[model samples]
Structure formats: C-alpha cells, structure tokens
Target chain A: MEQDLSAPGILTSQLDQAIGWARKYSIFQYPFVTACCGMEFMSVACSHYDIDRFGAGFPRFSPRQADVLMVVGTISHKIAPVLRRIYDQMAAPKWVVAFGVCTCTGGFYDNYATVQGIDTILPVDLYIPGCPPRPETVLEGLMLLQKKIQAQGRRA
Target chain B: MDLAPILSDIEALCGAPLSARGAGSDTVLTVPPAKARAAVEFLKAKHGFNVLVDLTCVDYQGFGKGTQNVSPAPEGRRFKLVYRLMALDAGTGLIKARLALDSWVDGESVPATIKDLFPAADWLEREVWDMFGVRFADRPDVKRILMYPEFTGHPLRKDYPIKKRQPLIGPADASARERLSPADLRPRIVE
Candidate 1:
C-alpha cells in the first residue's frame, strides 16, 4: 500500500553514526579563557590558523548554546565554583577540552590559590598539553575530540 | 628628594622617634603600631605621598632559624605590617616611602587604617586583614577580599599547614547556621 523510501541503490547507516557525524562536524565551543593561554586560543580561532576548517570556530559565550567547553587557562580555587556553575549550566551531550598545561594540571602553581587540575571540578574529555599549546596542537586536540565523539556515538 | 625633613616632620607629628634604616632615597622608617597612622597621615598630607602603593603583612615566625639566619622578633610581637607609599609629583620623578610597623600582631595591637587620608588604602587594608588576620580599627568594610567568606584561618599565616586542602562543594551562605572550622574542614593526614 505504501512505497518504500529506501529503494534500489540507497545507502544505509546506524542512527548513532549519523548523529555522531553530525555532532562532530558542528561543535559550537564555549571558551572559558582566564589567563595567558587565551592569546594562543585567539590565534587558533583566528583567520590564519582558521579553526573554522574543522567546524569549531564559532565561540558561543553562553553555555546553553555550546557543545564543547574549552577551559583555556589556570583554574584557581576562588574561580573553581564559577567554572563548575558554567559546566553545570551547559546542555547535555557536551564535551570539555583542557586547553593549557595549567588547566590540565595547575602548571607550576602548586599553591593554595590554584586548583591542582580542572578534572577535580569538571569531567575533562581531552587535554592539550602545553604552557599554551601551539595552534597545530589545538587542531589535533579538536580532531581527537571528533574521534572521541564518534566512538561515544558507536557505544551509545 | 631629601627625606630627612619629612622624617623629622613625621617624628614631630607622631611624637615618637622612628627607627630609620637604609640610606639616600631608599630609607625605610620603622614606626610603632600606635603612631603609624599619624605618621602616615602627616606624610600623605604634607610630604605629597599621595599614592598608597601597597600594604602587606609579614609573619616573623621561624626567623633566626633554618635558611634565613636573622634576629627573632620581640616577645608577643609576631607580625610586621609594611606600607609602601609613592609620591608621583611632577618635579620629583617618583619617590617611594617604606614604613614598617614593628611589634605588630593580629587583633589588638594591629595598626590603625590610613584610609581617611589615602582612599586607596581601603582595599590594601582589607587585603591585609584577610591574609594576616590583622584588624584595622575604624575600617567599616573588613570582610575577606582574597579568600571566600566561609574560608577558615588565614592561609598566609606561618602555622597554616601547607598540604591542607579545603575543597568547598557549594555556594556558601553568609548567614548559614552551621559553619566548618579549620580543624573540622582540614584534610586528614594519612600515614
């Protein structure tokens, strides 16, 4: 009684793969830039390095609209609550990238003021290790995140 | 600029002789806690020390021991409050005045605030109060500036445990009935 939508030479794939592919390609990032690493983040997102090629150039300031949280610098104990609040506010199906060595492990700030690592406050997906990672390193980190998204999709 | 005249003026105004150290433009005046405010006021009003560059507190604990071999502080006088004042007059390129309040302590013997004379001393005094537990009398707003309100014990104190971690979970209410003390909140020392 009804015509088949998938006829003849139609290619089929799992819903998870389709969703994963879509999600990976269009990652709207929310940059929680605090310190010096912000300069590197700017360079990576700007025209020369062009993070847009990977479809992650648009930096959404609001957490609600963002799919990825790129923590770009040192997270002090004083600022930890603020970081946690922003992470909690972001919609589900979100990922976090610790952009700098400071964000990854508090760098050399082994003091009362600095939080040892951001992972203690928020779950981190990937860590791009550098004082401030080069633009290429950031791009690689983005690619890794894409792969992670794809793998997570398969598992889901 | 000659600081002898200014030093004399400060000594006359405060009615106490200040122990001066260093020579030339880098003179440091060690004023008693009781007369620090008056001396600072005189310097600000007359000597053109308009900018309150910095106000910081130092704990003389464990002095004359370990790596730093220096003379220990006088009995019951554990702290020293240092005030750095700068005069940015057009004629004189930049004049720095260092005032040290020796025989100072946290609560009762702490120096008075110079916020009335130099408005910039407000935040610096608040910071000193926050870090060293030093009370600035006549300062209306003495709340903690660097550390959170719920934070117990000043971190900068010499006795504060270095590895002690205080991880706060949620937003702290100012008027919360139950508050955790330093002993209760400190991390358990594992063997």
Candidate 2:
C-alpha cells in the first residue's frame, strides 16, 4: 500500500442529507419542569415566545419519543429519582439542556435537598443561565442546537 | 368547632361511630385506621374538602410528656398522623384528620399508603417517612428521597444533632503535592 495519507476528511452527500433530515424534523422535548422555572418554560410554549419557530413545537409528555430533555427547574433530592426515571425513558441520541440557574446549578437552595446541578445524574449539552431564563434565551439555545447538529453532519 | 353536627352527618351515611377533636385550626376526625380511606372518601365526595394539602406525622415526645392530648396512649402512641385537606371549589372549607400513629400490631405502619386515592401522596408520604420515620406500608420506592442513599441520619427529627465537619475526602492540599520530590511523582521500579 502506498503512503499518501494527508487527505482532508470529506463530508459525503449522505452526511449532508442527514443534517437536512435533523433540521427538518421537530424536536420532541420532555420538559422536567418543577418549581418557579417550570412556569417560565410554560410561557415559552405559549403565544408570544412560540418555540415552534425553530422546529421545536410539540412538547412530548411521554419520554419514549422525545429527542431532548429540558430540565427547567431546581431538582431536589426528593424528586431526583423521578427525574432520572424520566431521563432514562427518553430515546437514544437524546440531548439535555439545563435551563435556568436552578437547573444548571442549584441557585439559592444550596441545602440538603437541592442538587447542585443536573449533570450529576444526566449528561448535559447546553447550560442556559438566568434566575429563570426568558423564552428568547431558550429559543437561542434551540438555534445553537441546530447549528451543532449541522456541524456534526453525522450522528455518533 | 361544630363536631356533633359533622359526626352525626357522617354516622347517618355510615353506621360506624366517628369522633372529632379540636387541634388548633384543624378539626381532626378520629376513625379506625382501617376505615381511614373510607372516611377520607366520604369527607371528599360528600362533605367537600377536595384538596389534599399535606399528610404528615408529628412525634409528640419533643413537645414534652402529657403536654398535648393529640396522643393519649403511652410509649409508641406518641406519634400523630395529620392529614390537612381543603375544599376545591366554592366552599373552600378546610378539614383535618388526626390518628394516633401508635401501632397495635407488630410490623405494622401508620397512615397506610394513601397512594391509591392520590398518587401525589407518594412524595408527601416519603417526606413524612424521611423526617418523622413514620412508616407507610406498600410505598413503591420507600428509600430516602431528600437525603442521599448512604446518609447516616434524618435531619428534621428533634433529637438529630446538627454539626459541620470536613468531608471524608477533604479538598486537595496543594502544599502536600509541592512537597513531593521529583522521584515521588514517578512510578517506582522494583529492582
């Protein structure tokens, strides 16, 4: 075998097709909402901030079909197992976006019950920070996720 | 406050006797533990009090011996099972049920799993179990919820001591690392 090994990694047409498919498909998010931040997540789903603009319309009540798990509120130790069960039920290639200061880091509830972060239980890809983040920030995170998918071009 | 009227109404519906007592703002109904679910159902369906606010237990020992009549029995009879309920719609009236958590039968637990009536009681019951150590029979995942699996003791109990100390694995002492010679960093080769 000849030793010409300096070739650039090429993205095939099939890889481009995969990226297109990911963008066209809507993200079914299993929102593990509790406490104050949960209310803000509901606002994002409502009229003004309609999250559907970024192909993330339907919030799936069931975890089996969901593509993303949005942990929107503070996870206390009491509810941590419940949250884990919900996360485990979601399909593969599932991404977790830790929404708000409470979900990303336990916020002011640095006591026994509150978990410092969602990452302790599940692998988190994105961190959105705010006491309770606005709907616009959530929409921005969705756009960032779409860009990340486009960059990967192929699923790992 | 009007215990007689309510007890008479309940007796009319179900022939079994019922008793009522005053505990602060709560009108506590004392019924046989076996009839607890039936009593709650009658109170909710017929007498209003739709919302189940909280279900918890209080250990009367901390309050002092013979201070409160909430528990009349001695020894293990000191625990009280408190169920707070509220009307859902127009009435908005509140009612409570207080039962002596004193177990007569061996290996038996109190306020027996209200999960069948309200699944939301699962967490509330777990909280009671975690704090007061009041056992709820047939709880699905009855493990400690607020505390880690290996946590030594419950914090909420009156007797539980609160103290702060360094964790098992204390923060890395950088000075200890710096004191180590170059040879110490490298793996030792046995001759």
Candidate 3:
C-alpha cells in the first residue's frame, strides 16, 4: 500500500487542474434571443467575431443540453413564464448571462409589458450591458464567464 | 378631385348628407352609426374605395373632461369607430369615415359591422372590441386580438390605469395558487 505518496499528490493536483482547464474552455451556449439584440448576437457568432475560438461555437437550442443560457433581448411579462421554464429545464452547473440592457434592466422598455430584469426570474451569473452589446464586449463577457467557471471548478 | 358629385350620390343612399372634411388629398366623411354600414358599402361598390386600409376605435373619455379646449363631441357620444378606405387606382386616393357610438354603460350594441362588405374588418373589429370594449353586432368571432384571453379591462381606454398590472401566474386553472390579490384570484372561483 506504500505506493509513492508524494508522486500521487502531485499527479492528483495536476489532473484536477487539467479537468478545470477543460471545463473552462468547453461551454455549450443556449441563446434565448427575442429581439433586435439577436442581430448583434449573430455578428458575434459569425465569421468576423467567430465565437468558436472560445469553444462556445456550438449553440444548443434545447435547454437540457446547454451549460450557459445567453438571454439576448427584451423579455416581456407574457414570455417570462416560458423563459423561467427554459431556465428550470437546463441541467445542473448551469450559468446565465444577461446579454443586453433589456435582459439586464429592461433597457428603454420601462413599461408594463417588459420585465424589469431577467435576474428577478433567473439567477444571472454575468451581465453584458449594452442596448445591444458590441461583439468585442460579448467576447470579453465570454472570457469572464470562463474565469468564473475555472474558479468554480477549483472550489468544487 | 371634387367629391361633391360622389357626396350627393352617398347622401341619396344614406338619406342624409355625410359631414365631410378635407385634409390634403384625403376626404373624411362623418356618418351616423345607423348609416355607417350602408355608407361604407356604397363607397366601396360605387366610388371604388376598394381597399380597407385600416379600421380602429377612439375613446373620447378625456376630450371634454379637463381645461383642454379641444373640440368635443355632443353630450352622450363617447366613442368613434374609424375606417380608412383607400382607392388604389391610378388617380383615386383615400377616404376616412367615422361612426360615433354612445358609451358602453347601458350595454348597447354598435348596430352594424362592415366585415361582410370587407373581409379585412374581421381582425380590425376584433382589435376595436379588445381595446375599447365596443361590441360589433352580428360578428361571430369577436374576441381579443392584441391582448391575451385572460386579460381584463380594455387597455386603450382613456380611463384605464397605466400602471395596472395583470401578471398571470402558472396555468389558467392554477389561479388558486396565486396569493397576490383576492380580485386576481376571483376569476378562478367558478361559482
């Protein structure tokens, strides 16, 4: 049973680090796009911005398969229940990123129709604030989410 | 471009001359509620007003209420259903007609519907019913078009509260679980 205890500790730590790194890179995104911000989201995912470089190129339509929920536009009160159900359907270790000002704080639609913020219904892990955030900002948000995932993996 | 020749013909059919007002290339004809359908039919069939551009309603609740010195309708008339008809021919342009109706307090019907004459009035009349609580008589499929079925109150009315919220919780039958307000839950109680 005395099988090199020092070597085993180093190998275990290295393996954990490798697992965390892998988890940080691979993110299956569910884009819950509703309005004009979807156009900006397209630009980010397209060839010019190419979200594939960060390993989040594959967009999962079904919430069950997705690890990240990218809420992209204005969510009206009528659609809130649907959004909530989608968030609930997502598997565990899930993350939510509010992609635009509408998802963050309802943008200019401060009316009875629009939801004030998606965070009231869904737990938001990141907020990318803009009327429709630029592709560069979206990339930065992705990087930030990666760091968060790495930190969470380290803790786990 | 003189509509007097056509106006005399409409007056003969309607039994009264329609009060006409000109705005640029368009002429607006104000017809009584009783003669509204006949007037619309005559204009469409004879005057070549082929397209029903838009049909809507206006609530005159706040028109004569305050210090605003804007033009007000006669005492009891509270709503106006407007129909915009467009003649898409090379020379012909547009005609707008308005039919005034009393308030919905005594539960009186608006009497006629042009849905038979113009198929486009189907959704338009439904929208008017949804927004202004004006019921179009003889129309079978009169239901809320823009708003959800569960939504209460005509939202476009001037008297409607702007901040009023009707947040639906769960399924329509699951209204019992809602603890927001007694009034909100009252619809679920089928007594």
Candidate 4:
C-alpha cells in the first residue's frame, strides 16, 4: 500500500532486511582445505549434497573475492602465518567457519605443531563439530551462517 | 640377498662398525661420531647404498622410563642419530639392500654433515636439527624445515614440553600487524 500510488509494482520492505536477504543468498565461499576434513568438504559440494540450492555452489579460490572462509582441516603452527595472511587478504564482510573438530579445538593433536584452534588467529563465525563433520552437518552450518548474515546485517 | 650376510661382511665393506648388531631382521651399525660420515660414504661407493631414506635423532633423556623406541643410547651418549640408507637395483627397480647407521650424538659434539655423500641428506639433516636441536658441522646452510624460524626449541626432544606452541601470529603474540581479525567481530560460540 505504501508504494501503491507513487511506485506501482514496487514491493515494500525494510532497507536493512532487503539488503540482508540479498546478501545472505549469494554467498561467495573460499575453501581453505589443509588436511583430511577436505574429503567431507568435497562430498558436500558434490551432486548429492547440492550446496547450489543455498546459493553457495560456486567456490571463489581467491581470498579477496570470497565472503566465507571455510577452514576445513588442521592448522599447524608452521602454517599459522600463512593462514593469518590469507585471512588478512580477504575483504571485510567476511566470515570464517571452522568445519571440523581439529579446527574447532585442535582435535586430538594438542601438541607442538598444531594451533590449538583457528579462532585464536581469525574471527570465526561458525564451528561445525565432528571429526570431519557429515555433509548434513555442513548444510546445517551453512544455513546457520545464512541466519547470522540476516540477523547481524554484516557489511553490505 | 637377505642382507644378513652383509652384516657379517660389514668389516670387509666399510671397516668394523663400533658395534654391529641386528635390530629385528635388519642390521644396525653403531659408529663413533668421527667415523659416521666415512661409513656412509663406504656404503655408497662399494655397496650401492645410495639412497638416504631417512636421517633422524633420538634423545634418550629418560630411556629407562619408556625404552620401546631404541635400545638405550650406546656408549652413554644421551642422543643417538640414526641414518637409514637404501639401495635399489636400477634395471629391476627393486630394493637391493637396506642398512641403518647409528652414531653417538651429544650436545658438545657436532656430527659431520653427509649431504655431499647423498644429495637427499640435505633436507633430512635439517629436519633432524629442527626436531632434535642437533646441528651438523660443514652443512652449507641450517634452517628449520618443518617449524618456523622463530621456533625456539627442538620440539621432539624429551625435555621439550609437548603443549608448547610458538605461533607467529595470534593472540599469543598479537601485534598491530598481526591483529588482522577485529576483536569485536570474534563470533560468540553458538550451541
């Protein structure tokens, strides 16, 4: 009704909500796969999992082009600097998902080489548990990210 | 050949080992620090033990506690450096022989670098140094191959704490340059 007379055919919605809705749908994700959890990540992207339905099928290999950083495996201290650099290179309005137990709390590798968790270096958005989380769990995590994208209204 | 005879004829191949003994089915030669390089050189020149399969260190700080990995360091040496050598028959493309060289490694003594004898020993020696704090004399360059340069101690040493972490960039060593992720954006752990 607000747009009935002045702007016919125009739908009315809050500016932030409209923006959030659009941003949440077109997710540009970067897969930072380092170890075994990468297997689950690969299956999630296959035909069976069908991640494209959520509008995140395309993977942007370049850090700058992506909005989501899917850290899918163990992050060793030797590679910590490189991970930090990749996280720094990504543009703002970005989110990180710790996609396995190792990335969440260093899994069972609570030793000298592995970083306790990636969160110590990068700002993480979601943590999907499981040794290598099942594809279903990854989908759930992705949906939660979409919700968070809508809730907080992260950078346009 | 089963390689068992080579153990007996080892003196004919490369002089007598400090203590020639069999570890399981394989032959192990314990040589003094001064003779390690020469023994490996002899094995390569005459016996076709050309490949340096692995070179590693074992710190026996508490061998009596958990003595499974290796027999207590020979000759009262706290650190024992093991060099694994392999020889492959060229035409057959099959392993011809395998010999392990054991030598005394101590903090005061520097082991001779064998990179010249086996080109592959370049990285393996560096790894041994990186993980066990053992350095080789006459090595062209010494750098940490697995751990970062800033890493302080050799992690595999029995004395080194397992939980010790030397992160180059993180909350542990956060500087302005490394504080890339905004603190305010650190997402709350959601159940």
Top model number, lDDT? 4
TM-score of chain B of each: 0.77, 0.61, 0.74, 0.78
Please compute DockQ, using alpha carbons, for every candidate against the native two-chain complex: 0.13, 0.05, 0.09, 0.31
List TM-score (chain A only) for every prediction.
Answer: 0.90, 0.85, 0.90, 0.89
Q: Which of the CAPRI classes, incorrect, acceptable, medium or high, describes model 2?
A: incorrect
Reference-based TM-score, model 2 = 0.51
> Candidate 4, residues B107-171: lDDT per residue as tens digits?
66789999888888888889988988889999647998998888899999898976566787775
Name the regions of candidate 3 deviating beyond 4 angstroms.
Answer: A1-20, A154-156, B64-69, B90-111, B169-191
> What is the Cα-based lDDT of residue B96 in candidate 3?
36
The lDDT for every candidate, in the order shown, is: 0.76, 0.63, 0.73, 0.79
lDDT of 2 by residue, A1-156 (tens): 595544543446566767656753567888888878888888898777988877787889899988888898888765777888888888776778888877665666655456666666666777777778777777777776666656545562
Residue B157, candidate 1: Cα error in Å is 1.0
Q: Write the per-residue lDDT of candidate 2 for residues B119-163, one digit (tens) a residue.
A: 777888787777667767776468776666656555565555533
Per-prediction fnat: 0.08, 0.03, 0.06, 0.48
Candidate 3 is graded, for docking, as incorrect
From the highest DockQ down, the ranking of the candidates is 4, 1, 3, 2
lDDT of 3 by residue, A1-156 (tens): 877766658876776677668877888999999999999999999989999999998899999999899899998777888999999999887889888878776677755467766766777888777778888888888888887777666553
- Name the DockQ score for candidate 1: 0.13
Better of 1 and 4 by TM-score: 4
Best by TM-score: 4
RMSD over all Cα atoms, model 4: 5.5
- Cα lDDT for residue B135, candidate 1: 77
CA lDDT, candidate 3, residue B163 = 65
Report the Cα interface RMSD of each model, rounded to 1 decimal. 13.0, 15.0, 15.0, 6.8
Q: Which ten residues in a row have the lowest lDDT in candidate 1 chain A?
A: A5-14
Q: TM-score of model 3 relative to the true fold?
A: 0.78
Docking class of 4: acceptable
Write model 3 residue lDDT over B1-191, tens digit each, in one string. Answer: 45667777877876875577764346666777777788788878877777887888777766855776774454566677777776566454434332221222212556488889899898898988888788888965678887777788887787778766565542222213312232321111111
